[model samples]
Target: MSDAVAAPVLTIDGPSGSGKGTISRAVAAHLGWHYLDSGALYRAVGVAAGWNDIDLADPAALVRCTFDTRVGFRDAPGGEPRVLINDVDATDELRTETAGAAASAIAAIPEVRAALKERQRAFRQAPGLVADGRDMGTVIFPDARWKVFLTASAEERAERRYKQLMDKGVSVTLAGLLREILARDARDANRPVAPLRPAEDAVRIDTTGMGIDDVVARVLALIDG
Candidate 1:
């Protein structure tokens, strides 16, 4: 493939609260490249399914949801990612924990994955893309020139999530968050399709107690290498 057509992609895959979202956004902004929050795409899809009263358990419903869904990202270059569904700004609603659970639930549907696969790939256009999600490196952008799998201890991740929600004035328990994180991890790891896993060639980083800049620096160093 020509260099222009073969746009470089940096795939950062990890579970929730692993700092993938923050690090990927920073990297994309630093490089002046396009940013793809693949998780947000699924979250938006889940929100759309809920709005249409579609059953996420129904495989056919999942297929239709993916086909009929319209997700857009505003200010994806260097600002807070805002998601729009069907031309309507659903950013706030899609950021809720409820929406995230729905995303985790629907992401396991094979039909839904197939439907949105090309949509994710389409983001690999001119310039480049920093794609972040559970399976970005393994499934969404297997040919990405740089691949990093970020992770953190479950307890640490839970604490991080708790702090974020508390900062937003959302009442939540760290213990509850920990339980939910473990459950989601099990689900993601055991999902039949596109299960959460680092690609064989991926470099894994444990951000247990590291600050965002430290982790970002490590990833940037990897990119430089």
Candidate 2:
């Protein structure tokens, strides 16, 4: 492989609403590197499966959908990246709680992870890659030069998510979001395959009260040091 193909990666792993997505994108843009939102990939797969009526309970069907799914991403500066599923813009749908639940369910299947592993790695190229997801540092890019794990209180994360949804005009209660965040945290941390956890060498950032720019600066500092 050429040097560009083997470009360094900065993996930012964290639970939902901990700001990894925002931070990673900022850092990547600052460094002029590519960005990978692995969670979006899973969401895309889940969304596609639903469209095809493939039962999430059926590991076989989910794996097939993963293989057949043609996921795409479009950069939308200053906003969330647009996600396309099989040539259709499913960006809005992919961000819904329903899609998140489905993604979580299918992500636990070893077969689904295996199928998406290479697809995730393919984003590494050119200047570098900044990957954001639960296992970006642990499973997908263990050799990443810069690995950071972000975290926040479950309640805080839920509140952040609640406000985001409300801003988007989605009707949701903070209590329900809190419950879902807690449940997903437990499920992700306990899943049998590639469970969610920080790599031993990863720098842990408690972003409970930190601003997005501050967090991005801290991540960039890692490269400077």
TM-scores of the models, in the order given = 0.95, 0.98
Q: How accurate is candidate 1 locally (lDDT)?
A: 0.90
lDDT of 1 by residue, 123-180 (tens): 8976888999999999988889999999999999999999988987889999999999
Worst 10 residues of 1 by lDDT: 73-82
Give the number of the best model, judged by TM-score.
Answer: 2
Q: Candidates' lDDT values, in order?
A: 0.90, 0.93
Superposition error at 49 for model 2 (Å): 0.9
User: Where does model 2 exceed 4 Å of error?
Assistant: none
